[model samples]
Target chain A: MKSGALRASVQLSRSTFTLDVDIAVAAGETVAVVGPNGAGKSTLLSIVAGLLVPEAGRIEIAGVAVDDVAAGIHVPPERRAVGLVFQDHLLFPHLSALENVAFGLRSRGVPKPEARQRAAVWLERLGVAHRAGARPRSLSGGEAQRVALARSLAIEPDVLLLDEPLSALDVETRDRVRSELRTHLAGFAGPRVVVTHDPVEAMVLADRMVVLEGGRVSHDGTPAELTRHPRTHYVARFVGLNLYCGQASGSTLDVDGGGRIVAAPDEPVEGQAAATVRPQAVSLHLQRPEGTPRNVWPGRVVGVDATGERVRVEVESEPPVIAEITPAALADLRLASGDEVWVSIKATDVHLEPA
Target chain B: MTTPLPVRVLAAVGFAFVLLPFLGLLQRTPWSQLPSLVTRPDVRQALRLSILTSLAAMFLAIVLGVPLAWVLARTHIPGRSVARAIVTLPMVLPPVVGGAALLFALGRNGLVGQYLDDWFDIRLPFTTVAVVLAQTFVSMPFLVVTVEAALRSTDVRYEQAAATLGAGRWTTFRRVTLPSVAPSVLAGAVLCWARALGEFGATISFAGNLEGRTETVPLAIYIELQRDRDAAIAMSLVLVVISLVVLVALRDRWYRVQG
Candidate 1:
């Protein structure tokens, strides 16, 4: 991979919201900016792509000062070496798929034939060469998105920004296009940022995850680190983990309300800490039994919700526990609302993050 | 789910109110002598002049009105509503009033026209150019209003996408914005040409009905009405047929409303 970096601090004030964030991406890095709707995810990409002007701060792409408020320098979007694929794949409806991909080249003064040749190459590379002659309105959703991707990538941009590239596709098409996008991003040397509301997509396409909430960066780390120890409830919920914040000593975590959790292999976190345990790690039992598992609590079932093949049993224990059990296991245990049950979790299942 | 009987009767009355005049003109037309009537030297001259002036007026309106529409629709020019009202004033104003206003602006010894006549020796009133100018003055507002509405409704994100793809402002407008609003432009131009072809009051007021120079079909029809009503009816029937054919052909081919 070639060396290219994008570093920027963006600040904007709007009537509905204010966005202030500083982000950096080194060469060959793909960072997923994940957030719910209206969390400033698209705004961040827009600022980096020079589509929106910042109120303050600066942006440098590939060592070029694209925007510097104090220096009073701002490069127009057309001159900036940043490519963005909008959420809706805003391809030129009047142009063919190949022409849409060739637009950037033609605008930059490349010869017509050469630009078309290069656009064809990109279309083939993105697996949409057969549909190159079709206009955007005629192309399928997935095919249009692929053409949009090819169009952006054809510019050989120093920084690439994708705003929810797969959110428009159907479930079946999403998976295939996602993997294809991953392959393309892996080969591109530029610093790439993919903004998506789906944590699953972030995990699949990004090297690092940056979670935004209400226009603020709530968490930034590797996918594993974020999933293992989410700092906020949104992040924890996003990764489907049960998180608790309390005080921790050598091997035990004192639950804020009542019960104590013992850690099998505890790290050196002594004060305020958080522990995340996957719902799959907790098991339900008919009665108080279990010798191997250290943590056990008796609680009544608050709710039983089924998602996909697994049934989630929410137990109102001391700190409240969610246990994922198979439907067969659920039927065997006859777990329903207001049913008494015992939940057991191995201490090793709890991953702690020291605050 | 069905229209009331009274409403249907009112609609038919409205339709007949507009169609009756054309039917009356067709009935009065001298069918056997139509060829001779149209081939009269004065009628032939008026036909050629009317076609020339209307075409010229349509061309001028397109060249000037499209950009004005863009400014009105896309830019944040202060007092935009006031500007739009002024541009569309000719649409509603009496054609003779519009002609008088043009004379005040462009006639010899008039405000700007005095200097034009003194310095450039270009006397505008009662000339062929004045006929084109009068037609353009009355017809341009239609084009501007239609094109402006089209421009306002175009998706601006397409232009943003073009900019991000490295196309500058002018290139984006030429390649993306213009093409997007082309159907409206064509429709506006056709309407403008039709209005210009039928202009009578403004042309007579601003550009007097000269023999072969400034006399258009409408002016010729007005003149022939005083001498021979059959010739006037013949000319009116020709205009009605031409307008119907042009409008139907254009709407069917170019501007068919999408479902």
Candidate 2:
């Protein structure tokens, strides 16, 4: 089998916003669509799932053309064999967990006993076998979502549509559930699309990540590619890179707001562009250190906080920076909130992107 | 003394309006004449007629009304609003007007009756069948509106989920939809039955209240109030008791309403 493929580009025109995008995911491949609040990520998922027919688009899922308005080839959601797991789980409140999972089988003409048996296997795989007899209201959020996953998988759908699967969980639970979801997803051989605003979920869950900004693809690459060079402020913020727009002619580059800084000549920029550097790339010193570092700025610490095992200092430097230092380094430097610090970073850490 | 003030007031007023009138009927009843009055053939016939006609009317209403309610609640057809309006017209229409309308449409010289008489010399007005029609026409909307509201408020996502699982539309409706809306359907059924049981004006006008053919308990009580007060009072008590018992029993059983 050639598996699943989608060459669909959906465009929806609303008075307030127009959604235009093209996406593809091969069989057994997980594609993570990530963006900011109004990035139309969910709208793209909706069009692929056949929940909303795009105002204009060609949707070919698993080699079947589902939405071809000109050819009158609009297959409804029910017939498309594409499973949609909603943000809220959307488990039928009236049905027991076992029944909820068994429902997909019933719809597919499987015998009742056989359907229940198959659903039991799915529930067991998700480690919710004990909760199969309970109602959705009685189950916890994580358990209900597991049941929803079982319900969707019971029919053996060609494509799985996951919208913010881990977004509803508490932080601790999100990590555990995302790992468990990864295990289950790895076992299933189908094209899957997961939507999320969290970079952690996207990078950890998807095989190939696609970023949508302003209803268009700003970047398409692996999780590493986006973190390496963030063209937009949204991606820069996500990867914890300081982004600045400016003019760069040679070793001495004057950024629009952050004053002048040196960038390599080999940096690619043909027009208006941006430069990004990770806070970790900036080395903090108690005094103005003398060296040939391409970027070095002095600032008084504004705030200090410990996150996880690292102490992060908020500084009031030109084009301000947030530097993350190990607790060992913090203790050695005896860092304080009002301490004056010089931040030095190597030239290679600075990434350039056309605006 | 410490009972909530609202609760105490509610109990006092509710008992006065609901139970005191039946108590007054019981107090004024002529116990010696009760047996003979009820045993009389005319009273027996009217009681039988009332029970048969009201039940038939309620049954007929449910058969047509439930589907209508489902359509109004689910579909967005252009004329659906008008259809719902037309279904409710009879509920608010004056009983005499509805009776007269039925007569014009199905009476001996009326459009439907004219055709019937021309073909088989048959007509609907002034018959037992007419009594059922009159009661049903005046009562069906109560059932339809109640069920429609229930269906409208129900979560439709469950139905969508069922379809995604592989169940067709009809199966989803039969197994899931109907069970989900069962409570409302029962409530509507009870209301329709009560309305049909109490139906009076249309039954008299369209069915022509006669001694055995059309005289239900309401008409019987009316005629006897002028000729025989004791018998009329006795029958009034019977009708009131039956209505109370039916309402209380159904509410408790279906709606889980405490006494």
Candidate 3:
């Protein structure tokens, strides 16, 4: 019930899909909702922004009830003090940067002169004052993004929602804009929600990450926590770790599908648990060799994907694992699809968590 | 790609069919007497009345047609397709038929006109106002159809952006939606004005061609052709020039929208 807090429990059903989620963010906290396509990430933001009405739920922003289906108190989007930055920025094509920033203020009954002056201040703060007279179509992508952020922030809303803010930028501009966005987001004194599918962006901008899969929150944790113990296959793939669920007893764990992984003897695991192995820790050899490695499995290479400076080799072993190796190592192994290989993992590298 | 020879030959024929009338008008024009013919009091009166009434009709079309267009393009009202068809009926209906229909509804002894006469003492037929109304009846469809098409194709996301910025529906339409489609609106207005300026059958049937009252340039031309062919030719030339100007000004906009 804090003044700047945002809380929502929404349930909406469409013909094709249903979204039901409950989330709460304290004042001054930034939470990132990361999910794959069609997971209702945008729908969640829309509900909180008052652009969409939930079938049966309540949404409160800054301790004010914006939507309550049972209470029949559904505020329209224009009345809700929520600022939304769409993926493409959606800058008014006909207006100059200064006028675009002043739109919200002018709409709220601010006098033209004062609104323009305040908008000028925001433009200066965002480092786009020089382009204030330029139309949105004339401004560069980075400039437009800064103007969009300024426009949303100029409203001085109780809560801010950004939907895939950096997804529209090219690779080169995304990094620069992302860092600038983080600084701007930190300056806002309200609950902030960012929706994105990129794991790196979620890790960098958000204080906490909420993983949404199939319109449900599959995992919610800090970057490090989620990286260490991913609860679902999507999160496991997101962090590039090989995950397995099994029954763990003492130092050994029996995987559910079909594999046995030995854990470090120091950490005793009991009952049903999950284990994670970093792709970097899995070494592949052409033949089974004698080594200090506690876990070794013979499997056939099912796929090889060369990404950047590393190659990910998918092996159809007992548990089916993905191994990341350098191109030099791949060249030496000459790994390709359908090649036979032996995979080895050190016991210490196998981290286990209770499922 | 080159068009086939038969297609090219047939296209030339069609083009010539359209252009031949303008060439005939130019050939028959009394260039030496044009100055005296166009400056006659009756000719000037008709010209002034035509400009005034057509401008009035164009204004009325914008006021009424924009909202109609918005409803057609944005709303899911019941019988929307039927409503759209009814609104566009004047475009295909003969001008004389449309005028006759208007007479049955708004004439002094007619359905709504009888009530207006009883309660407000207002008569619409045979007045200068009737000319404008008849012209608007025929020309408004052009504006409505053009604007509705533009509205349908416009991006709705900008309006959503406006809402999130604390703009109410009216403000969003005025500031964002209207400006985004301003070009199309201008093109539609010009077309409406041109159509209104050339309206003839509707004005003659519904409003009656009373000189200096409802006798617009087109009606004046028909009346003058019986006695003063040169004056009629001069007035026709004026209308043709005005229409040509409108078409040239709107050419790029029309092509951009269609293409």
Candidate 4:
């Protein structure tokens, strides 16, 4: 059996929603499960952590059968050798920083002094050695989270699960802690599953990203692939790509909303497909540009909003599209709500995926 | 702003209703003769017995009630609501009735007590242990209710974190759960001990006021009231002073409710 491997097929049903997905992570791979709220990202982690038992599932961690419903083998959370850092960094308030980190060792029957020594080493490794004697209440949010991470890592678990690890921090702290967390996770050599709603966090921390929607794995690929060719509407919106779902014949794709767009030559000839065009690929022109290399369409500017250094111009076309242009371009075009505009895209720039 | 006349009058009356009796008791107390009155051999014996029985009762309450509280708070035990209501029944029941119930269950030749006497020659009634049991019967509900409320309000994610850190359920409870609710446990133990010390109707009905073995301060006060009024007043003064000191010391800790 390989070390730090996890394979699980989780199935759970509630009156309002159902979560059924099969997922796996190899040794030293950090898989980020990205989703909107109530999309079962936390539920998936909880199932793997043995905190919530799925109605049906088989879980194998490091080739060990942690839960096999057919065999009635359900290992309890304490015996699973899986570490989970909760969303809020739920550090035990009563214990000092060192004791909280040492809790795992002491519970597993290490002597007090040895456990304390090991905990101190973990604290030092996480760069929180100076706060070893402070209680959780005295520590700031980042410090408490580091203690929580140390407490989880002290067990030397086969799999590490982080549920929204950086969501509880302020923006500045979140950025710093996220980078620190990524560094620490890289050193653990375990199958780490991080659940987060932030696309940037997913892209920065994970080797692979799994996009979950309505409790299903809607997209599974490398961060580059997801960024270049997102599959779902949520992913497309998240990665800021213009996605269209339609049927394709030869190189031309007919989007569902009666608009036709050309796909890349390498894309499938005839089948249901999705085409993703980056917002940057869609150019705004005052008038139709003369060219055989472009797919031009007339659209009404429904709204214009500034995001970061770019302004996103929402074009109310048959199949709506967002064009990311420089703020200077926005100023030159004078793009505002209810303004008429011409949108153009090159066929070579449109990336297509099988829906 | 001025308070309404009716509200002020009603509030004053409510304060008087609770305070006037204690004032009258203090006024009647033979403070000058208190030392001699309380130094009587029987009074000293009763004081010792009261402390012993109440402390013993408190020990039992903590040992048994904490687990019961956890069971009530954390588990999905069937009929848990019914179980909680039953556990709190003693708090509302008349102490004399609770004593009667205890007698039927533990008295010699009564229900389980008859079997105990027949099989092991154990007679529980009218004994020092019986006094403790009677006090415990009426006091344990306080501990259970307080601790269970604390456990229910506690954030359980810490326990989950402990489990992920390889701590078993028992370890989590001891290391994580117990410490988180320590203040409530201490508060509950104090309330239980106080209730046990004030136990009279149950202790008298069950343990029968034996001077050295089973007679507690409350029981001694009752017995002395019929024979010597000054001694009774002295005993009452001692109980009042001790209770006041305990309540005052712990007021901010347990009595000051949080929003």
Per-prediction CA RMSD (Å): 3.7, 5.1, 2.5, 3.4
lDDT of 4 at A202: 93
After TM-score superposition, what is the CA distance of residue A117 in candidate 4 from its true location, in Å? 0.4
How far residue A352's Cα lies from its native spot in candidate 3, in Å, is 2.9
* Candidate 1 C-alpha lDDT tens digits along A268-328: 6688877788999999998997598988889999999996689988889888878888999
Best by DockQ: 3
Ranking by DockQ: 3, 4, 1, 2
| Candidate 1 docking classification | medium
C-alpha TM-score for every candidate: 0.89, 0.81, 0.94, 0.90
Q: How many backbone collisions does model 1 have?
A: 0
Better of 2 and 4 by TM-score: 4
- Name the regions of candidate 4 deviating beyond 4 angstroms: A248-254, A257-271, A280-307, A311-318, A322-355, B1-9, B255-259
What CAPRI-style quality would you assign to candidate 3? high
Model 3 chain A: worst 10 consecutive residues (lDDT sum): A1-10
* Chain B TM-score against the true chain B, each candidate: 0.96, 0.89, 0.96, 0.95
lDDT string for model 3 (A95-154, tens) is 999999999999999999999999999999999999999999899888988999999999
**How would you encode candidate 4's per-residue C-alpha lDDT over B157-206 as one tens digit per residue?**
88888888889998998999998888899999999999999999888888
lDDT of 1 at A282: 92
The all-Cα superposition gives candidate 3 an RMSD in Å to the true structure of 2.5
Best by TM-score: 3
Model 1 clashing residue pairs (backbone):
none
Better of 1 and 4 by DockQ: 4
